[model samples]
Each structure stands twice: as structure tokens, then as C-alpha cells.
Target: MNVTLRQLRAFVALVRTGSFTAASRHLHVTQSALSGLIKELEHGLDVQLVERSTRRVQLSEIGEAFYPWAAKMLEDLDSALRAIADIKELQTGVVRIAAPQLMACTLLPDMVTAFTRQHGAIKVRLVDCAVEEVLDSVQRGEVDFGIGPERALTAETTARPLFDLPFVAIFPPDHPLARLNRVTWKDALAYPMISLRGEYTRRLSADLQAVHPELMLEPVHEVAFMTTAISMVKAGQGITTALPYGLSIIEQGQLEARVLDGPRISRRFHIFARKNRVLSPAAAGFCDFLVQACLKQDWVRLPEAVSR
Candidate 1:
């Protein structure tokens, strides 16, 4: 029937304490206010919930039957509210993010590890997909946001530039290019280049081409993944180029990495999210954390880490 929470609270307090004075004192409300709430509850429910006397307070038969349900309803509501508060405070929740395969393996894992170290209660999910798929996932609202190269966003999306990572050449220790502290496009082209048959190679070709129209990068081998290209390079197949964000992986492969010069091009990393939507606390916190973390990255610095 239209019973109010305050009325239910007054009824329960009076029944538990067995004294109007004690119930009112427990509720920190005036005795008359407490009595009126119980009366409203009874009127609203059309039942005599309590028998009030100057000496004692007692629940009627129907009131005793409803007590458990009323108490449970209040308890559940309080629990739900507490859960919402916890999510808002970042004490609990999950953050879903989409990233290109390279970043998912390298930069994203580092950022996730750093974030979770501080906010252990929050779980982070990374969807490692192709470059186009990263944008598609974000556009479809499949994840909280996407992190990848800057691209033309749909009207519904927005992007914030996180950092720019320069291209670095990686090769076997004894490779000729490895002898140079810094290599140029011509220096790398002198050797057979092993490259990924992916967006990165395509983007690099376009960027370098813009600087010199006739420049040609004929790879001795093109593979579908960076790791494959890296393996080939480790076998002394040829040198390959990639952004320095994941230099650690190159090091693990026993390959020497050096900054690439000539045109001094770099790829810009951006954080993508829906334009009009609000990010949950965890997602927003992650965006901030990622930006800060990238700023601290040695490779993200320009003119110092690499030629450009």
C-alpha cells in the first residue's frame, strides 16, 4: 500500500525498543514525530501495527508478520546504495579498454599493472584487437575507451593525444645497422628490411613517402605480426622498424634497437572515447593514469628520445 521508509523505520524502532521515549531517542526525532510516523504507517497500511501505552510499546499481529519483510527491504536498499558509493569511489568496479595488438602487449600491460598496483579492487580488461577493430569496438560501445594511433573519429567519438612514439630500428647484435647509435632511412634501406604486413608498415610508408615521394621500402619479407618480423630479425633475416613504446620486448629478443632518422617521423598515440557519454570513475581514472604514465615514459619524449 504506499507505506513510507520513515514509517517502516519508526514502526521497527518502536517495536525493538519497547518504549516510545527510547525509540524517539534512538531515531533522534521528537517523541511526537516518532508517534506520528507510526500512525501514518498504520493508516497507510490500514492495520494497527502497534499498541502504544504510556508504559510500553508492542507490535500487533499483522505488524509482527510484516516486520521481517520491512527490515529486509531497508537492508537491501542500504546495500545497493553502498555498492553504488563504492563504484563511485573506485573502491570496486571494472574498466574495459580496447587497444591495438601492439599496445595491448606492451604499453597497455605496463599501464594496467601500474594502475592495479594502486587500485587493487578495480579490475581492468584489455581487448587486444587490430587497429581498425580497436576503433570499431569503441564506436560500438563495447569498451570504456580505445587507445591507439590518431585517426579520423566518427562524429560520436573524441580523441585525446596521449603521446608520440618514434620509430626505432631493431636488428641482431651483429647486424651492420646495429653498429650505428642512430640509423637513418637510407642506412636501414641498405639492408633487407623485415616488416609487418599491417597498418603500422602502411602508415610508416605513407608518412615517409609524404616526405620523399620517390622513396621505396621494398621489404625482403612481410609478415602479419610484429613478433614474426622480430623473430626473422633475430635469425639475421633483416632489420625491422617499430615504435619504441615496446623496446623492452625488442631487448628480450636479444635485438639491438636504435632511433630512426631521415624524415624523423613519429606516430601519435591517442585515447578515444564517446563524445557525449560520461566515463565511469574507473574509466576516467584510467585515462588520467595512462596519460600520466605515458608522460613518464622515456620514449614518449620528443627531440630527446629520438631524432624528432
Candidate 2:
């Protein structure tokens, strides 16, 4: 009824090498010790597993039948142990993340590049979608985590604040607003604005209204994606407001990103993960690295209570 790994290893080695002396040499064990292990294995299994002669060692009928199974067991065990070691060393893993399109295009790429350089063995997969989709991805267990703005986290998901990206005005380089050191929300509202549709626009309006009730945001264009809004701004259609996180995209579109003041409005981005799920070591490591990288940025304000 009792079995041990040492006994199984000895049996398999004896079969492979075809001699107790050779098997002992391969295992770095005394021949007597190797023979004793085989005896113990045979006694425990209540079967004769080897036929021995002065000239050679061969597997008996029962041992021959079990050899394949024993070899397979050892192979599987070795693979499992190696995988564990790889995980511990951060030498193998996949870190899946879902993030808003704007962030995926801007803030995330730099973080990903830095992370992959330091951890060449670990792979990162990013799914760029809407803010809502990012939340859904984490809640549905589709990603190791999500990075986006604050949301109504379900009981199945948790959010940890990463950083707050102040709302910034994105405008074409030659636009009059771009000439200022900083653009005020009031000044931003006066322009023909290109705005994001749905929740983002609503939140911007609501938050701005709470602070400056007399203010109004009337957009000449409303788009589903930030890229579209950026496109509109680049064409000199109008200015748009977005978190500074997407500065790369704005810069790519030949637009300038200046912090919006007059009462700085910022959107807080969070790291979202399943409530009870344990992240892979690679994912956890990336999360820590991302927080530190974000903190180094001048515009990213980390909450005082946040931790690695």
C-alpha cells in the first residue's frame, strides 16, 4: 500500500540502464543502495519486478508491464517541478491585461516595454477596449487584471487605485489655447470641442458642473473613441479634453497636451482584479512595477495610501 518516489526512480533507472551497476553510477548511489531500493519497491508492491543475473539485469514480466507507466510518472513529476521553479524565478508566465483603448495606446505601451525588457521570459497580452469592457474583463476572469478609471466594482472584483491622471486639453499645436502654459477648464469649454460619447462625456459634464455649475460643454463633434477625437483635434476641428495618460496618442496626432486647471479635474485609474483570485507571480510583479513607473511620471499622482 506504500509507495515512494525514490523506489520508483530506482526501478525505472534499472530498466533503462539494464544493469544495477550502471544505474547506480548514473544515480550517484552505491550499487547496494540501488539494489535495496529495488527490493523495497518489490516488497511494497508484492511483485517481483526484475530478473537478475551475474551478466545482466532485466525487467521481469510485471516490471516490463509497469516500466512505461513508471517512466511516464517520472516525466510528469519532473515537468511539474520545473514549471514550479520557472514560476518562482519569473522565467515563464503570461500576464494578461485589459485596458481602455487610450491607455493601451499610450501609458501601457511604455510600461509594457519596460516590463518586458526586465522580464524577457514573461509575455504580456493586452486587450484594448472601452472602460466598461476593461471592468468586465476582470470581473469575468478573462484577464489577470484591468487598468482603467474608477467604476462600480462588483462583489466579485476589487479595485486598487494606481494613479490619478488630471484632465488635460489636447489641441493642435498652432491653436491659440496651445500657446498658454496651462489651459483652464473654463477656457477649454469655450472652444468648439470634440468629446467622447456616453459615460465619459457625461462624467466630464457632471464633474465640471459640480464645481462650476454655470459652465457648459457643447461639443461640435462626439465620437466613440479617443482616436477619433484626437483626429478631429489634429484637423483643427476643435479642442478636446482627456486624461494626460493618453499624451502619446495626442502627441502622435501632432497635438499638444496641457494640464486643465481652473480647478484641476482628474480621473483616477485603478488596478482591477478578481476579488478572490490569486494572480500569477508574473502578473503580480508587473503590477508592482507599473505602480512604481507611474509614480515617476510628473502628471501621475499616486494616492498617499497606495502601496506596492
Candidate 3:
């Protein structure tokens, strides 16, 4: 009852050293202070913990029983503190992130590789899901955070701006549109277009219609994943539009990307997380690193507000 760590330490030090002077030296406290602590501990416990003598000290029956318990408590606390220190220093921890499958395959892999190389002990786990499911993973507590294009956010979630990149037209290297330095929406739409299904195409169409009503994204095919669209483009099925961040996949597909102008429609990407939840040190650190990585890319135009 009302026992303090200093009192327990003093009792343990006295038992281990077998003398008041030695215990005081071990604790870097004066002999009188050490004696006072020991007295306080015994008084609080209502037991004579130490048999004090002029030249030696010994633990009483109750002290002998409590020594192991107190020592264990201190040892466990120290171990926990060390573990926290390791996490804070980025020496060891896990950062769980979710993203659209295309980003998980293209942009996130490179960024994760760079981050892990710098912080060798920290592990980054990326969950690849549908573009629409990125925020669902975050809300369900499946990931520490998520990266995806801006969407209607719910009150249970928070979004931090990551990148605002202009849409680019992607086609095979030999395609006629590849000749242009920059392709317009009309130019890209001239060919059979393959667009992503659901919210993505809807948002792009809405943005386009807002500026140029006559120009619409009437795609010949609507696919779920960007890779599928890119694959189709590579095979000469049709051309597609995507943000510049997917250039890696486009290049790997033996395709080319050109900036799409004529209203210059852009999409904003954000880091999504559960509202009012505190991110771990590793998660927060990786989020900052990701923002810096995006900043380094010339094509990525970040918003005025940074990550929360």
C-alpha cells in the first residue's frame, strides 16, 4: 500500500550490497537517504523487511518473499520501456498500409523498398485491394492507413492530402496518338477508350463535363483495375487514361504516357485513416516519408495541407 519504486529499489540494493554504505553508493544516494527509504518501505508494508546491524544487513522473512516479485516488476517494466524506445527510434516496428492494387504494384513497392532500406528493422505491409475498398480497409481496422484517390469521406474517417496529379493518356508506343507531345481528352477519346469502371470513370466524366460539356468519356470497355486497362492498351485493343503515378506500369507494359490537356483534369489522392485514432510511431514515420517521396516527384503536385 502506497509503496514507491525508490523504496523497493533501496530495499533491493541494501539486500544485494549487504551494507548501508554500499547500497547508498550503488543507488548514487547518500547513506542517510537510503536508510530513510528503507524505513519508509518497511513502514508502508507494516513489516520489518531488513534486519539492520552495524556492519551488515539481511532480508527478513517477508522481504525474502517480496524481493523476487519486486525485481520481476522492475525487469518487466524496463523491458517494456526498451521496446517502446526501439519503436520510437524506428529500429523495430510494423506499418500496415492499404492501397489500390495498381498503386500497390507500381508506386508503393518502390516507396516501400526505399523506406525499408533506410529503416532496415521496420517492416511495411501493403494490402492491395480494389480502388473502392481502400477506405474500407482503413475503416475496418485492417490497416493503419490507406492511399487512394479522393472520395466522399465519412465522419468515421479522416483524409490527408497526398498528391494531386494530372491525368495522362496511355497508349502503345506505335500508336498514332504517341506522336503528340501532349494529348487532349478529345484526341485520346478519338481512339477506342478503355476506362476504369465505377467511381473513377464517373468522377473523371463529371470533372470533364464541368469544363467541356461536349467532350465525354464514352469508353468502349470498362475494367476494374488499371493494369487490365494498360494490358488492353498494350495489346492494341484501346487507349486508356490514368494518373502519371502509374507510369511505371505503363512503361513496363511497353506503352507510353503523355500529359492530357484541354481542361487539364487532375485527381487528388489522400492518406485515409480512422477518425480520432492515433497512429503508431512507425505508421506516422512512414506517412511522413511517403509525403516526402511524393514531393520529390515533379509530376506530383501536393496540396497546401500536409498529413495530420
Candidate 4:
């Protein structure tokens, strides 16, 4: 009814050592204290648990039956505590993250690789979906957190700025835009643009309208993934726009990227998580590692106005 772990431990220790002096020594407590704990346990259970004498001690009928259960309970509790300690130390656990396909392919893989190298036992599970799906994944509790450009926050989600980066123009080496020392939105818009469809294009258009009302991104082709846009650019179909983090993909596609200027617009990326839920130790550690990793990269800059 009112049994305590201390009482249970004393009972088990006495049974194991078979003597009051040895049990108290093992528990680092005085013999009287150990005797009191055993008495308390038996009193709470309303049963005699120990047959005590001057030379030896042994379990009564009920004590023998309860000893195994108490020992097993303590063993299980110890194992659980050890597991939590391992997670806190980042020695073992899994971190689930969701991001846009481009970032999943370009930025996240390298970051995850670096993190795993440092925390060899932790596993990072990355979910790569469409740009619009990043927030959806977070809202649905499918991931520990989601990373992408800022979006309209829902009531169930919270956003924290990760980094802010200006857009860059991606074009083939031989393209006319590639020759320009400084490419502006106007210059890039002059050509047929290949843009990501859905919220990405909508947001870019809105941002452009806020800066230069007359300039708009009317892409010749609209696709779901940045990889597709890069493929189109590689085929000389059209130039595309991306953040600086996508430089690896651009380079791999045999395309060059120039920073966009002339009313330069930048997008802020954020880490999105469920509003009321707490992140696991592994997830929180991975998030911190990601922030530090971004800070080290020249391409990723935390705006002075933004704070964690």
C-alpha cells in the first residue's frame, strides 16, 4: 500500500546477503537503519517477510514469493534509467527530420553524415518530400522537426529561423545569363525560367511583387522538385533560381549560379516543430548540431535581425 523502493531494496539486500550486518554494509547504511527499512516493508504489506535471528536471516513464505518480483522490478528500473542516460549522452537514439527534396539531396545528407560521424551510434532518418509537404509533415507528427523556407504558420506549429539566404540564378555555362558578372532578377526573368511549382513559385512571386511590382516570375516550365529544374537547366531548357545551399546540385548539373541582385530578395528558412510537443534528446541535439553546422558554412548566414 505504501511500499517504498528503499524498503524493497533493503528486503532484497537482506535476502541476498543472508545477514543484517552484511546487508547494511552492502547498502552503505547502519544495521539499525536496514532493520527499520525491512520492518517498514513488512508492516506496509501486512506480512512477515523475514525470519530474523542472531546468526542468520532468511525469507519467510511470502518474502520468498515477493523477492523475485521486487528484484526483477529493480532490475528493469535500472535498465530503463541506463537507456535514458544513453539517450541524454547521444550515445544511442534516432532523430527523424523532414525537408524538401532539394535540401534532402544537397544540404541535409552532408550535415547528417557529419553528425553521425560525431555520434556514431545515433541514426538520423530523413524524409524528403515536396516543398509544401515539409510543414505538413511536422504538423502531422511524422517527424521530430521539419526544415524549409518560411511559410504561413498553422495554429499547431512553431517556427524558428534557421538561416536567411538570397536567391541565385542557375544556368548552363554557355547560357547568356552565365556571362553576366552580376545577374539580377530582371536579367534572369528576361529568359524563359524553370521554377518549382506550388507554394515556392507563389511565394517568390509575392516577394518579387513586394520589391518590384512590374517584375514577375513567369516560368516557361513549372516542376515539383528542384532536381527537375536543374535537369531542365542542364538540357538548356531554361534557367532556374535557387538558394545558395543548392550550389552542389548546380555544380553537379554542370550549371553555374550567380547571386541575384537589383532589389535583392532573401528567404528565411526555419525549423518547424509541433507547438506543444517536446523534442527527444536525439532530436534536440541534432537540431543544435544543424544550427552550428550552418553557422560554419559561408553560404548560410543567420540574419542580424533573426534570433534563435
Candidate 5:
């Protein structure tokens, strides 16, 4: 109805504190004022929110269900107001991102960390899922943007190449390919392998076939995740190839890798946002940070001079 923010705030205070006196203390209002606000809210909503007996106060069933939602409404309202205030003060609002799972695991944590350290007030929520899921979420305006292999963006979405991720091979330290700085595509095919069981994997196989048109590769097993495929290779199940950071994940001490010599097989890691999505200031800050971070890593990881 016509309930005001102040009234809602007062109701939340009493609901949280469980008594008018305590709520009055916390709200810095007289007990009578807090009690009056509750009465006004009941009149507006035509329901009893608080049950009053001498010993204590309790929320009616409707009040119990309504309190959390009311609190969230107030919280969201406050966040929006604060974000607007920040804009005037040169700060951005929160940014919610849904990133591809493997990239989220290896890359996003660092991006979020550095961004938070730089902009203390900007809020960031990063959700991790597969490429298809990321695309769907962004399309639905559930996230500000996504990073991974760019699938075809829907008409309502926009995407751009952020970077290229070369497919690198991972083998145990003593494996045959380990001694070589780079091994040819045909050389890689000769080894038993584990690989992702998705479009990316098909692309890799096709890329291999480009160099060896007659060649065919059937992995030991197809997996749903890049990390899992990498793990399989590291456990010595067989050798495998993955996006560059898939190799970086190895450096975390659970695996190892080397550049695969081929026709430069790599996937485009792209930045995607819904065509008409409204991004909060915080989200926009994160988007900029992610692009910059990936660019820096690209510079740093461009096949070391020794390997080239």
C-alpha cells in the first residue's frame, strides 16, 4: 500500500529485536513512536504483525513469513540507494558475474581479489557454471557478463574476443613428450589421451585432423569438465590437451604441462554481455578488470622465449 521506508525500517527493527523497547533502543526512537509505527503498518496491511502480552512479543504467522522478505526488500532498497550515492561520489554499484566453471576456478578468484582490494565498496558475486549455462544465464540477464569459449550469442546478447587460449598438453614429468619443449600435433595423437567430451573437444579433434586429414582420435574417456580431464591426465591415466589456464591449474601443484606443437590450436575466450542488460557500477568495474587481467596474463604467458 502506501507504507513508507521509515515505517518499513521500524517494522524490521521490532521484528529483529522481538520487542518494542529493544527496537526503540536500537532505532534511537521512543518506545511510543516504534509502537505507533507498528500500528500504522497493521492498519495499512490490515493484519496483526506483533502479538503483545505482558511478558514478551511474538510475530504472528503472517509476520514471520513477511519479515525476511521485508528485510530483503529494505536491504535491496538500501543497496540501490547506496549505489546511486556512490555514483555521485565516483563509486560503482555491485556487479554479479557468472563465469565458465574452469575459468572461474583458475582465473576469476584472482580477478575478484584484486578488484576488491582496489575498490573496497564495489560488490562482486561470481557464479561458476559450464559454457552453455553461462550463456543462458547472461541471456536471461541473470549475470552481467561471462568469460569462456564464446558460443554463438543469441540475438539479444553481444560478445567479443577477449583473448586466445592455446591448447597445451599435460603429461607426467617423465613422459616422452615431457623432454620436448613442443611436440607436433601428430606426435600428440600417437599417445593415449583423456579429453573434454564437448564441442571444444570436437574442435580440438578437427584441428588435429586439419594437420593430419587421415588421422582420427578417440579419447580414453570423455568428461564434462576441463579440470576433470586435466586431473585424469595428471593421475597418469593418459596425456591430454586443454586451454592454457587448464595448464596453469596444473602449476597449482596438482598437475604439469607443456606447449603442444600443432597448427596453433586454441579457442577464443570472449567477453559476453546481454545486449540490453543493465549493469551496476560494481559489475562494470569487474568487467573492465577481467579484460585487463586476461590481457596481462596473455602478455605473460605468450610462449616463453626459451620454448619458442
Candidate 6:
């Protein structure tokens, strides 16, 4: 405890090679500095650590008993330091993310899997949030990043456009458009529609309005979330629209999904990171992986079932 790590290292090297010059070379230090460190350590412990003459040096009684202990202690300390370095250098730390429920189901699971494989020591936390909540969390510094549709974001945050997901029609198997591969917006117009209402905190209804301006999107059944909208479609009550590239649980559970070609209401998936904020090295690497993932255009491919 009274001695420094340098002192212990020098002592170990001197004993291992039984020569001051060899220990100095081993430690990359001058022989005089190494001699001072060894003497300082011996003086602190009040023990005769080394027997020295003009050209020869030998361990004393106390030094003989301590040689193995000092060497082992230094080795253990070095190993611990290397482990901590790996945790930081290898992108091993906790990262929190805010994602929309649809993305939590559609894209994030696979992304998380790949990320964890490469960085097994990193801890990841995923929050199933609305698009507006995701934006708020990222801006407020509660989350490292957010993934959702691109909307009006503050200038402090930088967003990368990931992909464009077109609208898909959701209907029961017995519905008229169920048999079609791709149904036009006019096809949906013929029937009453159900939709997620009050899903976004912002006053702007960006997705629907951006797609259909001239025609009214008569929401016969207004629900609070995507799950509710899917429920309505399953009940044979009315049909709704979803992201063509993204899959809903309703696709496998109770309803059919058809791509809509005419209205072509697609959205830009954006990855949000606060601008000018210093990110931890691990978080920055994770963001890089996210960007590479976005460019690959592989998020839309869904497996047969949800692995949640």
C-alpha cells in the first residue's frame, strides 16, 4: 500500500533477471531511476530488500519471502487494468434507445441482436415509445438515440434518413382487397377505414395528410394505438393502413396486409442523435453501426412471426 506500482514492477524485474541493468532495460527506465524506486520501496517497508556490491546484486531475507507475492500482485493489477480498458475500447457500456412500438416489433430486435453479438459486454435498454415521445427523449438527453418516422425535429438534433416505407392496407382475409397483392388508395376509399388517432402529440397529422390531401380519410373507427387499429381490422369492422416495409402482428395473427400503390404514402425512417453533444465512444460506435444498418435497406424484411 505504501509502495507504488512502479516500485513493485521494478523489484519484480530486478529479481527475475538478478541484475540492475537488465531490470532497467526491462522497465524502459534508467538504471539510476530503477535503483531509486527499489530503494524508496525498501525504505518505506523498513526491510532489507536487496544485497548489492560493485557488480553483483542478490535478494535479502525479506525480499525472498516477498518476491512471488509482489510479482503476482503486479500481474493481477495489470490484468484488471487491461479488462477495464477493453470495456471502454471495445464499446462495452450501457446504451438506452427510444423506439416506436412498430419498430420495436419490426426492426429493432434484429439490430439489437447484431449489436450485442459484436459487443457482448454492452448493455442495451429499449423503450417502446410513441414517435413524439422518442423525439422528446432524445432531445431531453434521456436516450442515446431514437428511431422513427422523420418529422419536424429541433435543430439541435441530427437525423439520418434511413428508408422510405410505403403505406400498406390491412384487411381481414374475407375482405375484398385481401386477395390483391397491392391495393390502390381508391380501393380503400370504397370501404370504411379504421386508424390510430391521437397517436402523435404534435397537432400535425403528417403521415395521413401527406398521402391523401384532396380526399378525406374518413376514420370510421378511431383507436389510440397500432394494436387497436389491428384489432379493428381483425374484427371485420373496417380496414386500415400500415407501413408496407414494416410488419404488424396483425399480419400473422388475424388480418391480411396488402401493399398500396396509388396513394404511395411512405415515410422516412430517421435515426436521431443530438448535435454538438459529446457522445461516449461506445455510443458513437453504436450510432455508426446504426447508420450502416440504415444504408443496407434490410430492415423491411420480416420473419414469419414476431420473436418478441
Q: Highest TM-score among the candidates is held by which one?
A: 4
lDDT of each: 0.83, 0.84, 0.87, 0.88, 0.76, 0.75
Ranking by lDDT: 4, 3, 2, 1, 5, 6
Regions of model 2 farther than 4 Å from truth: 15-36, 52-58, 301-308
Q: Output the number of the lDDT-best candidate.
A: 4
| Order of models, best TM-score first | 4, 3, 1, 2, 6, 5
Which regions of candidate 3 fall more than 4 Å away from where they truly are? 301-308
**Per-residue accuracy of model 1 over 1-308 as CA lDDT, tens digit each:** 88888988888788778788999999999999998998888898888888665366667789789889888888898899999998888888899999877778877887899899988999999998877688889988999999888788889999999988667888787777756766888788888998877676787788888997777788989887677788788787888888887666666538777777887777788899998888999999999999998888777755345332
After superposition, candidate 4 runs with Cα above 4 Å error: 301-308
* Predicted candidate 6 versus true structure: per-residue lDDT over 99-180, tens digit per residue: 8877777677787789889998887789887666888999999988888887787889988776766666778778888666
How many Å off is the CA of 58 in candidate 4? 1.6
Model 2: lowest-lDDT 10 consecutive positions: 299-308
Q: What is the lDDT for 56 in model 4?
A: 79
All models, RMSD in angstroms: 2.4, 4.3, 4.0, 3.5, 9.9, 5.6
Evaluate candidate 3 by giving its C-alpha RMSD to the native, one decimal: 4.0
The better candidate by lDDT, 4 or 6, is: 4
User: For candidate 2, what's the RMSD?
Assistant: 4.3
Error of 3 at 89 (Å): 2.1
Residue 223 deviation, candidate 2, in Å?
A: 1.3
Error of 2 at 82 (Å): 1.1
Candidate 3 per-residue lDDT over residues 44-104, each given as its tens digit: 9899888775346877888899889988887898899999999999888999999999899
